[model samples]
Target: MTIGAGGGSRSNSRSSRTNKYSTSKLRNSQHGSGAAGGGSALGGQPLNGPSMGPGKGDIKHRFEIIRKLGSGTYGKVSLAYDHKNEREVAVKLIKKSAIENKQDLVRIRREIRIMSALKHPNIIQIFEVFENRDKIILVMEYASGGELYDYVSTYGSLPEPEARRIFRQITSAVLYCHK
Candidate 1:
């Protein structure tokens, strides 16, 4: 449900307020944008990574769109060159409407805030948050290695010891969080 120009209220639950990005909203927005003739701005262009936020025409920023990485219900990802930094970054542009409710927006904002607080090798890093009139752009470090689930799923189940080792590694991350 796309909200009006003004954003909605905030949520209270931790899960509801944390990691609120959902596949459902991603799907809906993807469909709607497709209907509106907002095809990807990428195509044959070379992409450094995924970008988030407005399209090439819509955004007034000087970011040169290298290629489109992908998109979900909330927004599309593009590979862009940051003219100022002279570096590549993945930009995620999330529309306000992709949010299910006010709580969802709050959760996403919280996640961005948390990302700004951390610096670790094991954690995904968010570099900056750029806000235009209605949308939020999340510039993040691109992980090109793909997801661990994909590797696990493609290779089949791992041996018990290997799984345990991975679990231990995750446990170490949890411990770091606690610290």
Candidate 2:
């Protein structure tokens, strides 16, 4: 989906306060601790919808990798097309070998849970998670809008109004997470 440059004003600020309490309650119910939590933050529900078993083949069998988007110590992110959905997506490929211990694995799983739980318009959607013998592939929503830093570098400083608009979107997203 294309994220535009404006339209983030909220008329009822107090509604967020009410939503905070309800959201927390819903989260608590949906994400119980330990094995009871099931496979996902949504209380046993699969995060990526249906199961796609760990098969012995290339991830490219499912997604057509378009290009490398970015990289890090853990893994690389690539722009890809989902064959099943016929849409663009970002795939994060994390090597299984890079996970040092059980704790590290747990942390990665937690990150998946958190990302999958997020449903805000500003937040990227986690479409699917696939694990092979070597890597963990996360298929996520593709944001065509480049990084904020890159945007700033290309355009120089934004006007005050434009900056505020972006800032508001960022703050609203952060507030949603806080809730």
For candidate 2, give the lDDT of residue 26.
17
Worst 10 residues of 2 by lDDT: 34-43
Query: Would you give me the overall lDDT of model 2?
Result: 0.57
Q: Which stretches of candidate 1 lie over 4 Å from their true place?
A: 1-62, 159-169
lDDT per residue, candidate 2, 1-179, as tens digits?
Answer: 22423333211121222322322111223322211112222111233432344342234344555567777776777766555555666777777678888898878878887887788876777877765455666777777665667777877999999788778778878899999
Candidate models: Cα lDDT each: 0.50, 0.57
lDDT for 78 (candidate 2) = 74
Mark the 10 consecutive residues where model 1 has the least summed lDDT: 1-10
